[model samples]
Target: MSSRYQQGLGQDASSLSGPVRQRSKQACLPCRRRKRKCDGNLPCNICKGYGYDCEFDNGAQSANLKRPVPSDGSPQPGGKVTRLTYPQEHPKQPTESPFFPGILEPSKARYVGRYSSIAFPLYVGLEVQATKIPRLHSFAYHTGIRKEPPCAVTCEAAQKIPWNTARSLIEVYTATVHPVFGFLDMDQLYVRCEKHWHGQPQDLVFEAMMSGVIAMASLFSGTLDQDTEMWFILHAKEILEDCVISRFPSLEQIAAWTLRTIYMRCTARPHVTWLSSCTVMHLVEAAGLHHASEFVMQTTGNAAPSPEMFNIVNRVARVATSLHILIAFEYGRSIITLNGQILENLHPTTGAKDLTFQLCSLVAAVPTNLSGDALPMMQELFSSLDMITSVTVDHDFLLLLRADLALGIYRRLRVMDSKFQQGHNDRVIAAGTAALPAARRLASQNRPWWNVIGTVFQFACALLVMDTPTSCERLVETMDTLEMIVDHLNTHLAKEALSTARQLVRASLDKKRRGVESLEHIVRDASPDSTVSDTNDHLPQDTAAMSPSLTSQLPLDLDSLWAMEFQLPL
Candidate 1:
């Protein structure tokens, strides 16, 4: 009896209270926010069903269950008290954007659009497929943003496009974009175009690839008709994106993505385009294009390489490398590689001597702080690029590379002779001045084929206009030129870039009028290369001197708007 009593004393008194208790799962964040019941599965059925963020409240203390109070109104020795109650969350009536579901209030809707189909799947896995979707478009059924719209290119429309019209788009691509960046063999693509013109069943991947190429050609053709050019790109995007989700992709898939990536960069979102480019890089590596030498040896150890296989291998390596470099440079950063260095032989070349050397120069010019004059490098680059003046010989990728080169040099010009701070030296200003003719020439040549390309144009124009102490006339002319090209474009991005340019122009004009040394407000207030530009945008300080369109009325009654925005549900 004594031994048993001693043993009982040694055991934990808390454990003696009862058997181990079953833990009640904490409610998911969405369920808690919406006041819905949570089933507590990994996603919590409520969040999984509605497709909301399902993170848990880490701050809420875990509720430990204990033995219930004795039936006789005597509190047990180790009774648990549920102390993790939050203040009765007077549930706020969650307001949604009246105009666009994925969008916020009036101000922010312009850049990111109403909803991000990209953000919806991001919380879920990247490759998670919606197996039970009813609609043809998977995003509609899964994320439930909008109804599945009809395909842009219907069978009827496809039949209606004359073989001649289709042939013309192909011709445009061949004449303008090819010879420099040749992904598809012109002979084979021509044969396919001929076959499609006869109304035969082409491979779906092939059709998508062809659609993208034609769409790209149309944009550069300066035929601003939305129907003929932009429609083809949009239709092809749908088909290609669907192919990415539903089908086993091939080299055609790579080409299809390159088209989409380029279209997105020009027309809409730059960052999304960047991400897509990275995905293309990964896909290229996956397809063994990186090790084509090994691939040839593995398949045909004792035999000479077929011309067909060698050409395919060469094009893929070149396209993948150039696209990766250009995309990285576009976003204003050098490549951040974690793995060991790439093989000396493995690094892809741009194929053209002028482009290849300039590409190397751009890569070498990455260290942002150089004490010496950069004018020689800039001159050398321009001189090198000058060899190919004829647009007839210039490929589309080379054109983009040229603009990108201008963008890099323009950025370098801004950083000239100034320590860390963004200041314009007289020499730099002179360089900026010299760049104006080149910038204008480039804009005229490209005619705003891509979205960010317009921004590049805007940056150049603004720099030139701002560099002058008294060039209001030039600024007006610049605005007119920008409007003539960008204003005609259909995408919201064009307007966004134009607006940025105008703000800088207006701000610079204001600064000149006031005779201020600092261009701080213009730099601080402008949406230069932001992922999302905000609506709480400031008017130029000297707004009274500015145009009526440049100045708008702020709300006279802030309280009312505040009250409406800050209300909570009972």
Candidate 2:
């Protein structure tokens, strides 16, 4: 080789001046900025590697770049480069639909963005698709919370209350809660349970009866700490769990669950209440209480049960059935998959001037999920609303509440039915935007707790999922308003709800402002042996991080079941 160079009259190796630098035209623009090795292929390896809209320039000229890429072509010890090549720069063709830049294959991109198309099902982003709930750190349990059945607790606290102490609590309950629940009989409770109250503290029915009274009294008192409510519920639940584990089925067990459901409702745990309500229904059916009339006839036919005992079980069954129907409606679940027979036998126990009876009538009149003629359903709901023209101090506390709930449910049905309609969307936004403040106002004016807060919150969530600027703005406003009133809520359940609402709002805002880079959208690819750098952690200081917790928190895996239950704050 030396002899050939000498023969060709080339300059000596010493005179080459250290390989002579290119007087400075170097890597392409993207490679220069990313400090990556450029293959100099018009869309350089680095640009192509990151799905970036790559362009190029020398000292004299540059051209248009469109990208679909992996990482740069720079050599790592075991670097796995996905090399996507494209035509050399076409000066006339402009790129379209540029999304946020990312690393890896499109599916595994670190900072993935929404897929855009003129006519196809859009993937909002592979990242966003990963966290279906958009983890806003809200108190609302993600669908994956393993809800174990109720556990056995001694409820040493509940059993210790003296028999004499229950009278006032019972009075408070009869005065405040019974009017709404209507699932218990005061005369029978006072007459038949007095002996158990003074003597048998371990009696399940006695514990349930006192728990209801104490819990209701605590709630209606209006100033008790939220834990006090849970304490009452925990105590009551322990009592019932004892009966349930024993597989005991009785009219007393039915009454206990009715109280438990009421407590759950009062505490904003409607899903829990639904669970309790189903138990009540199960017991009702088991005891043949649902066939109250037949049971009465048969028992009378045998002369084995007194008419009074027969009437008690019959009324308890009737009220429990009514309550079940209402919960089913509120939860969008069909009760017993209601049919001609069940609907025929269905009636609200006819002994109370309370909200349950009113709701029972409405439930019997309007089918769950309202799939029939909209005109008739709307008219019936309106008729129910008309029955309560004004809410006065004398009015039952739950009257205006469940009425508002019916209206909210009606609106929800509208949102579901006309989802694609612009009018429906607009009305929903308007109603949800206006509704939360009204709820807060009502809570302030009357009671701190509203049975329908969950409905309103769910509606607000619906608005947010719409993903429009209007929806987002309304959600922010709703969260801000809820924030102001959250502290006033006396129960931890409702307080936790407002706190979670704020978290979700914050998460939504981060998602909106940061595009699709939030960590909730992070997807782990199939590469078991590959290690990817934290994409956002390496982000330049100029751009804000989408999720600060990206490095620490992993997006949780969940089922879609929790999403449905999220309709309530449970």
Candidate 3:
């Protein structure tokens, strides 16, 4: 029976060892658990079921589990070991990875198409079915359809964008024309400005446009890059030039509006920026209405006449003139010519006389040490005084202009006396003479009390030019006349008269000091060819120190008369 049992075990073992039958019975255990073929052996059925390596024991009982086996099927020196591998199964769609569930969904992995014929993978480790996605083709088509190549939208999730971005964009559009759309966006900005009108836009539109102006100015001033600056300048120049030509009638209003907005921007709380002021100056200067005539023409539709327009024009001109005169004075240049032109153009009907006087004061405030071209300009300015005498309106304003003009002439004469002892040019002297009749006539009228102050100051300046000491006696007589005028003004127009009288008195004192110094200088540097004898000369002792009665017969002091003082009535 034992023999029979041993024989049975041996037969079973022999059957397992047979190649074809063993292959059939010892199929992979992993394959069997997966309901597929499996090879059965010592570790066959159970190892395969657990997805572990199946090993066959030859002679070795203990094996090194740490060292991985080679796959070549060669017996290793220490032990015979073999590596087994199965073919990897791949999902049809690359996005179908179990690691990233739902990644393959059409909504999540929609493709953004490319225009080029070359196909690139949308993602790094995944293969996309490009044939199935229509969005990819649509993206390519749209991108290719753009006339100008589209720039990729950069992520701007950082700082606030500058306000000038819109202006810069418009500038870019204007400079570079796209194939599909040529400055379509820029045209909108242009049209908006062109259509804006008084009362129509109201505050809302004004605010919007003002914002745009600030932005454009910032862009043009090169707060941006060079390309942006170039673009803005080119487009801005074109727009402004066009506005100048086509919108000539509205130019003044527009300019005024722009200027007003800039002014507000400059003074706004917190302030805009440093470069904004420069931009404002640039815009104002570029408008080309700095001159009075241009200002009048621009503000008023008719260049012939318009009192209201003239008044506005006068104000604007005065402001601009004052600004320029301030600049010239600060830089040590002559402002006399500018003052002269402003005075000559003062309109009787438009109340510009005060403006004229203000500008004259501004000119006078400049240092008188200027020479050469500045001196000549002052001389020319003195010559234009003849026009003030003929003005027939606004006597108070005229008086102010005359007083200021007289003061200016006196200051110039003082400078000339100190520098050029040879005396002023014949033409300027003649012009002064021609202006005297008008001054005398205006002075004759009952005018503002300040007129007397101007008159007395004028007489004082003229007295210095007298060739004889007797003229000083005559000046004392004139002082009596001035005192009477002052008394009359103090009684009737005291309030308005004091300030002007005080100014005149100060000027007279200055003139006295200047005259004494000038006389001393003349005596010290007396040239043989000079007409008047040196102050040391007693003027021919036999001639007698003439009394006021004797000197009163002499001609009036025309060179020092304040003509405009009488031109503007009280």
Candidate 4:
């Protein structure tokens, strides 16, 4: 061997002369384990590289120092070798030998359960402490924290204990306390397996159990608390970020479900107060309907939703729609009346147009009966009208027309009796009439047929409310407006306006059922499906046959007169 190789071998030549020498010359044990090269050092360069507190076995050290010397000055069985060595000191006391009298064989040590007695008291104390802490008490209500109060207590206790004690407690708790809470507290159950026994082959078993528990809870409850909702959202988002988004795309399902449950609960009632409109909108966009549908399909299992479930879901959807409409209307109203900065930042025409279209769509979707909740909803609609009419007419003139017509019908029928209480009819009618002309003027410019029809209807309603025939002249002017609508009703706009006209006509006929024969004749002639005949051409033939004295003395039926005055068609 070269002097360099000889120098590489330690002076304890016998110990260096076997497989140990080969390994040391090639790579030190630490370096070999790390799969790296070793530089000659007391602690090999690899051990230093890895920052281990390197140690040497005393038997190995002694053997290296006792190698035999060769008689002929040639290399002998136990070769003379020089080795790199670290500076050291000799001990003042002799080291006790590991050998024993009986030469006891090495075997696996048996655990004698040293701390078993303390386990019961320790568990009891943990339970007491967990129940006492307010924060932990709140955590118990959390969906995944731990179902069983005691398990959560144990978990809290385990966190504070010494490692060996904690390990013992955890093992005992997992075997005993875990079964009770495993179904209740997912976080505690998961933490038990994840934190206590991590890195062992049993991690997959715990993970599968946790996944099962979570899946079951989601299936049954169909919801979670606010904090749990947030936790799942964040946790699932992280998992997707680390493993799913780019690589394992299928795992995106987890993130998708987390978001869907959060949204569903956020929008559902009782908890509806827990989330705002803006939050729900953002979550819905994030969850994406397709993903939510998939999650529902997968999780909703064999127990089909009961009638109550459907009702609850429908109610939630309706409420959400109402809230959205209310929000949009509030914005539109602010723009019109307050001249709010929100409007200044927006294009008035564009903003109004968008809001009007949305409001109309919402109105169309809102159920007409709405389970007798229509009054509050109508009040909200009318409030919007009051605001919009104060602004530029172009913003919501059509909506105002429709709203006024509906309000008029509502007041006359006493559908919302509370609104007209204490003789408030005159004020209501006056405010409504004052708001109509501007709306009518704007509607006439853009939608003439509707404006004329709506104007005539309002005029008739006004005349019916008037105390004297002096107001009959206003009826003459309303007749002129009706003529324009009649002209279009004979043309193409009939189909579009027919339903509204028919409803108005029906109300009028129902009111005037016992009035003058001429009124009854006019009602019989009005048909939404057929064009109106010229009443002027037929009037001479009809009126000549009636007795003037009888007509003069005829007391009009209040309902029939009201009905005839507003007659259009059903």
Candidate 5:
């Protein structure tokens, strides 16, 4: 064997006198089981390359001389890190280990800016028309370090904000935001709050959870401005820093992170919310909340979570999954992989709750490319969503669900395929038309939902694609709704997106209206009653010039609109 190959295989090539050097017995358990070469690192080269958790056998544990020390330079409690449980020396590095086939290097990780429409593109781009499919970029390892910034207010100070005031904020959050997210067990949160106020021992996670709740409540209640609300948010984050670094995050920690994500959304930080949502999903998996059945089965020790705990877990998991999925769909990338069985376990029996879960599941299944063969499945999903509209009134996010489906259809519709072009066009129009009214109603309510701008803008884009007189009028109406939403927004990316959409729609409307007028003038001059002769033109020269060309451009096609490359951030 060549020297390099022998060295890589952990075999000695220089010493022919000694027995052929065998692979290190100190290889991680995963490497050993898979019969792969290992460099015997804490996380062996092979295990790291395959993105597997590296564990060592008891006999091999002592052979690892390089110990991962805590920040304080003290040995870990056990005097040895085992199975990769010790906190990583460089926490800022990718959370997931590198996979050999699809390496996700830290340098490749990019911040999808607040203004970038790359995530929720007006169309799915050229992927639908290409013969070869593009490789999917996984954000699994693109994790940001979970460090907390210095907070202006401490947890104790936040707790002392007058019980009456605190109670009011919590109640407002429960009534407004809680119905939508439904992650928190209100009773449990109340109990924790009461205990903390009554001189009971403090729990950092619960405190963090309450702080997040207060911050969101403050935003929705209009009791505090963005700056004031941020104090509570910072307080929650400071507490969560400890929770995030813990070996195992608790349900409370997950709830706190979920709330933080929700707050970020309300403040119109889509990119930040995406990153935060990802962090929450990771915490969900860390808590083993994703695999419901398996989590309960795998519980150790005499203490198992109560039935209430199970319900809370399911609720949090459902919301976290839905939120992550929603953002992932927009970005065209995701880290979590949930299935129907897990969703079924998380779904509530009926009402708006059940409907929300159903919508999430349907959206998760939407294919990136809309081919003729995929129509049946898309139709079924669309049908399911339509049925949902009939049974339930739109709530905190129902409008968004509808808009997203319409946008998905618009993005992936294959206009060139004559075989399915008509079918494709029909689907986009119907979905857009259906979502328009819902978007109007949601915006008319004057509630500043985090997703309202994106949802309303999406419906408008879909209508613009139809390029019909009626669609234009509806698009105008949608723009009016967007105007109201933007007025309420606090100068965020969402506001800018809606403004951009409105401008494009207005320009398109003007061009279409001009085309109709030009056509009308030409028809008027050509009427039978007209005294003008065919050879001599009584009409103005410019009017005559417009007649021939105006007919071709009468119905504004998406060709020019597409050429502009107008993209709005979600």
Candidate 6:
């Protein structure tokens, strides 16, 4: 056998030179080490399933050429090269996973919608085959601030408010909303308001800014009814509409738009808030606020912007970035793309803002295509958030951060094509559980932010989809929080989705109980005393008949839940 094999291997290279054969694509290093077949995709199917970083040996083909010849007098190189060689692994440098090639294609234009994370449940609905989801327009609650006609108007038009009323509103704003964002310098704003109220000349920008502040203050303070609040908001938008927002936007313009976006957020107008947030980004970049130092240096006057101005600029930039990122990352869309590093470099930062920006940067790092390779990054971000000990950061913010991160991770995990769906359920449930307290706190407030209501509902839906014991427990807590938010806010769309999610959870729990009972019955019937031949007869003959309890309790089947339609108004 050895002689015959040797004779067969000794055949001349010319004898094998029929048509030049093409070589197959190279396997990734891990696959080659284990001697497993590889399809050679960016993340090969096997590596992707196992959650291993798929790496290729770029030098392998070249190294094959320099291999030493065999001693058997054949032209072929030495025995096949098997081991993969790599340099010392660096901890700081993560393996660069290939981005989804489709996004990188140069010829195509990318399209991103103006939707926030609050709308993420709709995608979950799609996954569960839920159908006839109402269009976003149907449930939209616009603040009915009529747009003024094209006729030109002076800043004086916005100054028709009673001085006492405006003063009280501004004070309310300075005390409540201003601390969270610090979008305006209260001292500067107060001085300006004093001047404007006394019939002194005021810029359109100042008028617009004052109007926006009053609008939000009225809404936040709850001193006025909804209609009264919308009246103030209308004046603000009218003044803002008059400002000539050129390439170089003024501080007041930035403040005006920022306040508008915040008001829209408080009102729970997701689409409007998204659009306003994008406008803020455009104005921010146009004014060069992202690089505060350079912006100060470029000031045309002998004296640059004051420290107070700089502080406001920095805070507004950070707050605007946060607002836009929260929505963009959740909905997986973007109109303006800001670099994480630019945000990471903001000056005079607070702990909460810094941590929040870091979170934003991490979120921005998530691949647009939702590749499984980003799991390591996602895990690291979540763990880092868990380790946060800064007292300056609001507890509610931290809770929402964890919940949002978990939801993001869950979405990323679902697309991984892994066989074990339960593998990451614990991690997601833990996150959802951690966020429940924050939801309750938000609900207990006079009025929760729109995001609070949306987040609680979405998390409940996510946990309902999970349908595990721990998840269901958390789901109940989440639903309770959602109910609180819905009752307090009285948002019809949330109320509708909340009802559907509750039914789904009930059905899921019932299905689990029935499953447990059926298993117990099988175990009892198959006792040692029972005849083996009779086991089949004793078992339920019709599989369809077994779920009668579930059918009677669950008015709609799983498919019916997906096909359920809603006519809820916006």
Q: Write the per-residue lDDT of candidate 3 for residues 359-397, one digit (tens) a residue.
A: 434343434344567667565545443343333333432
- lDDT by residue (1-570, candidate 6, tens digit) is 111212322333232322222333576687677665555555554454334577878765444334332111111011211111011112122233332111000011111121323233432442344444322221344666875345354665334666787788889877666655655668767777887888785766667677788878877677767776777678667766653323226556777887888788767566777888888887666554443121111101112223333345456676677667666566656646543334544443555344534444444433333335556656644443333312223546456655675676566445654333454566567666666777677666653455566667678878776666777667667877777777766767867867877787788779889999999998878867665565245545465754454434343356764665544559
Better of 1 and 5 by lDDT: 5
lDDT string for model 5 (48-140, tens) is 433468888776777763543222111111111111111212233223312122211111111121122432221132113333322223334
Quick one: ranking by lDDT, best first? 5, 6, 2, 1, 3, 4
Tell me the number of clashing residue pairs for each predicted model.
Answer: 5, 4, 20, 18, 0, 5
Question: What is the TM-score of candidate 5?
Answer: 0.57
Better of 1 and 6 by lDDT: 6
Candidate 5: residue 561 Cα off by (Å): 42
Native-referenced Cα lDDT, model 6: 0.54
Those runs of model 1 whose alpha carbons end farther than 4 Å from true positions after fitting are: 1-160, 222-231, 242-249, 292-304, 307-309, 332-403, 409-447, 451-499, 512-570
TM-score, structure 2 vs. true: 0.46
Note the Cα lDDT for every prediction shown. 0.46, 0.49, 0.35, 0.33, 0.55, 0.54
Please provide, for model 4 over 1-570, each residue's C-alpha lDDT reduced to its tens digit, 9 standing for 90 to 100.
011112222233233222232223333455445444444334443343223455445554344334332111111111111111211122121122222101000010001111234223322343354432221012223568544322111112223223453334335434332231121222444455455444332222233233323322332243335454344334433432342132211112222332333233323332332233433233222222111111111100111223222222222232233333333332222111110111111111232233423333333332222224666665654553344333332333334444443344444345444443323344334444554454445434433322335544555555554523543444455444555455544644434444444455466656666567778788788887565454333344555455564345344345654555343458
The stretch of ten residues in a row with the least summed lDDT in candidate 5 is 73-82
For candidate 4, report its TM-score. Answer: 0.23
In the order shown, what is each candidate's alpha-carbon RMSD? Answer: 27.1, 37.5, 37.1, 32.1, 19.3, 25.3
Model 1 poorest 10 in a row by lDDT: 80-89
| Residues 1-570, model 2: lDDT tens digits | 111212222222222112321222446775566555555455543454345566666432332223222221222111322221111112123232233222212111111121213101212221133333221121333676675456465535434455565566667667666765665667656654465555543455455655666777767664346686567677777677773443545556677777777666656466776887888777665554332121111100111123333344445666677677767666766575322223333234455444545544444544544557866666555544334322221233443344444445445555546333454456446545545656666566544344436645665567666778777777667666565556566557668888777677788778777765544344443354355456445445643343333323333223432443323235
Query: Model 1: per-residue lDDT, tens digit, 139-250?
Result: 5437666665543443322564677777787887776556445556677777876877686656665676777777777676754377666666666666766633323435
Error (Å) of candidate 2 at residue 529 is 64
